[model samples]
Target: MKFLYRILFDLNKEIEEEAIKEGIVYVLNYYKNEFILYIQAYMAEARWLNNNYQPTLEEYIRVSTISSGYCLITATCYIGMGNIATEDIFKWLTNKPKVIDVAIVLCRLMDDIVSNEFEQKRDHVSSFLECYMRQYNVSREGAVQEGRKRIVDAWKDINKESLMPTDVPRPFLTHIINLSRFMDVVYKDKDNFTHSEGEMKAFIKALLLDPMKI
Candidate 1:
């Protein structure tokens, strides 16, 4: 983390004027506060596991939104080299657009759907599956079926955002949509990310290890 801070410090020097650099530092500090709050919620979830406490669906979703790490990805992707983004665009995104919200929702729900089985075997926080099952008094299969429906709904929102009348740049919006698609592929059958010894491993080898015949 210290290395990351050093990189940011060096990056600030790339700005032409000291005033703009200082302003950027101030903005970074603001984002630091936001990140700390987000991480605190995740840590609180861990602490809740000690008591075997179950969070409501609302509570679960709220925390999952932050823990999904979409906020950091959106901030970096949307505010590019300043040509495609401006102060107005950044301010608009600060309000949290619908597309980004749904994209992260897709990520959190998909991850829980595929990973909750393994996660439940250990002392883990209450996932969406647990919240839904407890809330509705349903079986695991039932809860998963309903969770799949919500995932479909989130995709619809993502599709709508990708269309016209967008508040942010289409390119920025595409990055979020692509992230959802990538999550779908990754967590389709299992938690390929956490357990990468199967198809994901082969994929990595093909993409990175095996050199193409040039």
Candidate 2:
């Protein structure tokens, strides 16, 4: 953990030591209140393996939300995207606003759905699909249907947040929306991230390598 902290601090030191210090303080404060969350999330699958315990759908989703890396992504955007974004706005965003929460949920659920088939072939963590199946005593097909419903509901939350009046600027909120859209393509019909020998590679080549005609 110290290594991770040092790397983050050094990277930010290029900008300003004070900024790094403030970022550290923010992360420490966040962890002080929510440190147990990481443990619970990481240990979820271990508990399942040790005791054959399958968490309820709500339990699974709640814990899975933390492990979704939304907090890190949102914080990075606040600092990186906010060259002109004020400290107050960045602080407001780091407070886990509605838009961030919905975006995180969208990420978590869709990832689980698209990665379900691939992950099952290994000794992977118990996905939301497994949890839902055990909780409701449903078959794989039924659990998949339920999982799709939950994902759709998350999208509804994102759409509603997008339409509603917010204290932050639209561009900031759009960053989160774009994140969900990116996940859709990355994990659509397959877990392209983990098994990235196909279209994702082509995506990288086109986006980063291909020259555009002027």
Candidate 3:
């Protein structure tokens, strides 16, 4: 198990560097393959969980495999972004050193969304992706605009009351607010983007090896 973990870690680091030099196309493809593998493993675990009997060794292996996939995906994102501290994040991603910190926070939020139990809630992956996209802004008629404001406003109010005034930037706070709204749509939607076997293979190829068009 340790050997496998080490191998995955090393492979992830190499892929992360390549993806960074490439582009979002490569990153997206890489994540898609990882996501598919994890989902398959998760399905096995879900079946085990639904059975009347206790989990067997095989079931445990399935769960662990799923978890390893998740860990690799998370590591890839962190490594690709250069894994700077929250305070120094802005500097790493920007010339003026201001965007990195906010990007870090956004990455954390994205991680949370991915780790969330959306499958249990009967939510779909496309919905979650849409929610992540909306983290940048809010719309008036969308799902998030309906009731997400309350949760976001309350969180902001609580933070304001508890933290020092200088601890949080207004722009960052605003980003969180928008992110909250986007997540609402994700949590509520059920439709997922469907891909054929060929499409999936193509996505993997684009992500893992095609540096020219990453």
Stretches off by above 4 angstroms in model 1 are: 1-30, 79-83, 209-214
Off by over 4 Å in 3: 1-13, 16-75, 83-182, 192-214
Q: How does each model score on TM-score?
A: 0.81, 0.78, 0.26
Model 3 local distance difference test score: 0.42
lDDT of 2 by residue, 1-214 (tens): 8998798667655434444544533443333334345556767756766786767778777878887767656655555642455666657765788877777777887788888888889777688888878888899889878767867887898899899998888888888888888888887677888888999999998888995767
Residue by residue across 1-214, what tens digits does model 1's lDDT show? 7998798667544432432544443345434545676678778788778877889989989987888877766665543444455556666656778887788888888899999989989889989988999999999999899888988999988888788688766776777777788788788779999999998898779879995778
CA shift of 210, model 2, Å: 0.9
lDDT, residue 163, candidate 1: 80
How do these models rank on TM-score, best leading?
1, 2, 3
Give each model's whole-structure lDDT.
0.76, 0.73, 0.42
Which one wins on TM-score? Answer: 1
Ten consecutive residues with minimal summed lDDT in candidate 1?
A: 16-25
**By lDDT, who's the top model here?**
1
Clashes of each: 0, 0, 5
Q: After best superposition, candidate 3 residue 100: deviation in angstroms?
A: 19
Q: Give the clashing pairs for model 2.
A: none
Q: How far is 62's C-alpha from truth in model 2 (Å)?
A: 1.0
| Model 2 segments more than 4 A misplaced | 1-40, 43-52, 211-214
| Tens-digit lDDT track of model 3 for 1-214 | 6998698677756775666565533343545455566667666645645663344433443344344343334434433553231323232222312222232233323333334444436532222224433553544234334334433554455355334453344544344345434333333232211222454456556668784652
By TM-score, how accurate is candidate 3?
A: 0.26
